[model samples]
Target: MAKNKHSGKIVQNSRLLVGLVLLVLSIPYSAEARQKPNILWINCDDLGKELSSYGNQQVHTPVIDRLAREGQVFTNAYANAPVCSSSRSSQILGLYPTRLPILNHRNMSPVALPDSVPTIMQLFREAGYFCSNGAAGDLAKPGKEDYNFVAEDLFDGTDWRQRQEGQPFFAQVQIHEPHRTFVHDELHPIDPAEISLPALYPDHPLIRADWARYLESVQRADRWVGEILDRLEEDGELESTIVILYGDHGRPHLRDKQWLYEGGLAVPLIIRYPNSLNAGKVDHRLISLVDISASTLGLAGLPIPIDWDGKDIIGGAKNSYIYGFRQRCGDAVDDIRSISDGEYKLIWNRMPEQPYMQLSSYKKLQYPAYTLYRDLDQKGELSAPFSAFMATTKPDYELYHLKVDPYEIENLADNPAYQGELLRLKEQLERQLQAVETYPQEESEALIQQAKSSSRKYYQEAMQRRNLGPDPTDAEILDYWNHELLLNQKPKTKK
Candidate 1:
């Protein structure tokens, strides 16, 4: 296990002129793979490092834990963007969304990938390897393709079994478990009291119970992982295939998923290579999620695109910095950029005047905890740090020393003692920002209001179904979601 020590230092890199891949590898670059391994990408939705392998004992993910034991577990991996569509769109082409200028989530209009960059699926099919993207466990079912850009004919079929005999397969299996509206696992129940609430959340049973339910979704996803591996074993391909399991971004929580915080941008990455290569090793290399694409092309013995943003992570130099972005997620409109160099992180909130929860209809509908947070803050039950989240306005810049302040509750940006460090990273990140073409940040307010109006329809319907009184408190909202949705019981009769 590689240790990440806080040097309280910054290394200025002048070569951030391309993709959001400044965190380049320091190890010698090598792409020697004579035997092309069948790649299996198990991409789960809105999942973070909740598995036992990552040291969260509450969620019993034996299969994923076993994979961690038999594979290389990455400790420092961040998504290029917080939202799924933006991350998915840039990842396949081995570039960043801002560099490709496809930062919109659920974009009504999408541009095709640059003619220079060919998707890995197209290349794999051209190389005679079968490509499939389907649900986890049952590959016959069509999987989620929430790409922000226009991608066509990306898959050969829904399942690898349809491929010609002896043909290698590159399967992109998307697991939907653990996203939202978590399914309770009856067989392995977790105690609500056993959960640990983050500082951003109030220490309440409702919050813990909500967390336990999310763990149930994690358990369900884990069981399906076992089923996927079992099928590979039964088909006599387990030993020959290279399985790469990762989350699209982070957990589906109140402040996660759509934000640029660590809870939203961070994800779990595990690579199980055939013949037990690099098995049982825990690598703490600073890496971005897009590196998987470049690594994929290298693993397939194909020539990587010259303009591909990500580099081969298998054997690369130490990362200087990794960048992330948040822009136009769902009905919410915001522009936030982040740059981290393993120890220190800097977040630039372009629209700092706006409140954190500014008409994000998805959060209002899907997360009962969202209501609870606002209610608690309104009641003055929430203290410093966490209460700051509910503030009407945010600081233009936020900085955290991740090694010392892993939870990111402290704001070192305004502290006079850290002025030198703050300005250094700020100027450094600004230069990095200039390199990428993030045009969507300049989108009009009219376009945003139109999209918000469209998404509000679904939120209104869900709220109507619950039928909480117009002035219902957060307690009533939480209780409604808990009993009505999770327990499969109707909401309490509104009197």
Candidate 2:
């Protein structure tokens, strides 16, 4: 009987040991179930909210639409600026476009972000998350290279997929399709007659054909996004990843890109965070692309850097206002500033030297059909279908009631009825500008020096040429100096 009791106790201890083993195993699964999500930011170039999912019945974007269905859709999302570099800089840095001196669209020179300023990558890396970026086109070099993964191929996201095993990762995938220089024959096999022209464009056949080609390019970008999503699924990483798909800026056509109108600034933002987010929720709060940096940091379980000017959007705060500015696109130098509160938009043009409706770019000048629309607009022939996108210079103040006229066709600045609302937006714009404008000129100058120092090796070689260059003619000396400068500078890597 004692021998039988001993065997029974052994069995009981064995059962206890199995339970303990199960509990220990369950800990990791439970931890992993609550683990911080891996972030995948898919930033597309030159896409607007023209998808059927975003209330436009014109374009089809199945992958982006799927993301919207699976997560939250932000209809009132605005880029910090209407151009790629400025808007994208704001997205990663959480600073306004003007805060960076490179906000001037005409100044296309490299503007390296200071190393002292903390980026989302810096914050995530500190928090034990690996960061990788597959930036597209010219978006990968200069100030952005320090934070993003610089690679040869533009279409691949493999670098982002192979991060550390247990640690979370922040991967940014940028697509450069749909920007200008779209091929007509290859991209747009569809008939131009079938294309619906935005009222801002003259009903010219060439204009419609150009617009169709642009649409085709946008469709191609959607296909690339679908491929990325498929890759995530294949890697079994989709469920654990928080995917956000958005546009860097509006298109580079009429009423887009260089303007401060809805077509220029407003973009589609779809967040698919099944791990921590409730799906199918549509958020219409006026959130800027700058908020993207804050939201990214917040979701990564990192504190929003204090120097960041963007607001943390996960707290259900109703963002009432977002600002926008336009300097120079190509060669047009216009100082246009604007602010929007989802319901109303007010614009202030500091340089009232020219008419508000103008195009300074080479292509637009070359295409007489493109100028026809602007000429018609100046004559008030075409309804303000795309007035918000007009680059033409106007008087100091302009106002539009977005609730009544969402297209911003009618300017109410001269009307007495909206004096109160106009004044309110103006004050709010000034207040927000002042709040984030603390980046001192001296600080920026210091940052510029740091940026210059990054290319010191090239500068040293250029100085050698400068010392040897004492040509008889002034132009020859200048040419030699320029050649030296060019030789020393690092070239942008292959796409």
In model 2, state the lDDT of residue 393.
50
| C-alpha lDDT values of all predictions | 0.78, 0.64
lDDT of 1 by residue, 284-350 (tens): 9988887888787777666565555677787564567888888887788888888888888899999
The superposed Cα distance between candidate 1 and the true structure at residue 76, in angstroms, equals 0.6
TM-score of each predicted structure versus truth: 0.89, 0.73
Q: Against the hidden true structure, what lDDT does model 1 obtain?
A: 0.78
Q: Number of backbone collisions per candidate, in order?
A: 8, 6
Mark the 10 consecutive residues where model 2 has the least summed lDDT.
1-10
Pairs of colliding residues, candidate 1: 25-316, 25-317, 25-318, 26-316, 26-317, 26-318, 27-316, 27-317
Candidate 2, which segments miss by more than 4 Å at Cα?
Answer: 1-34, 106-115, 135-158, 183-190, 275-277, 356-359, 362-369, 372-393, 439-495
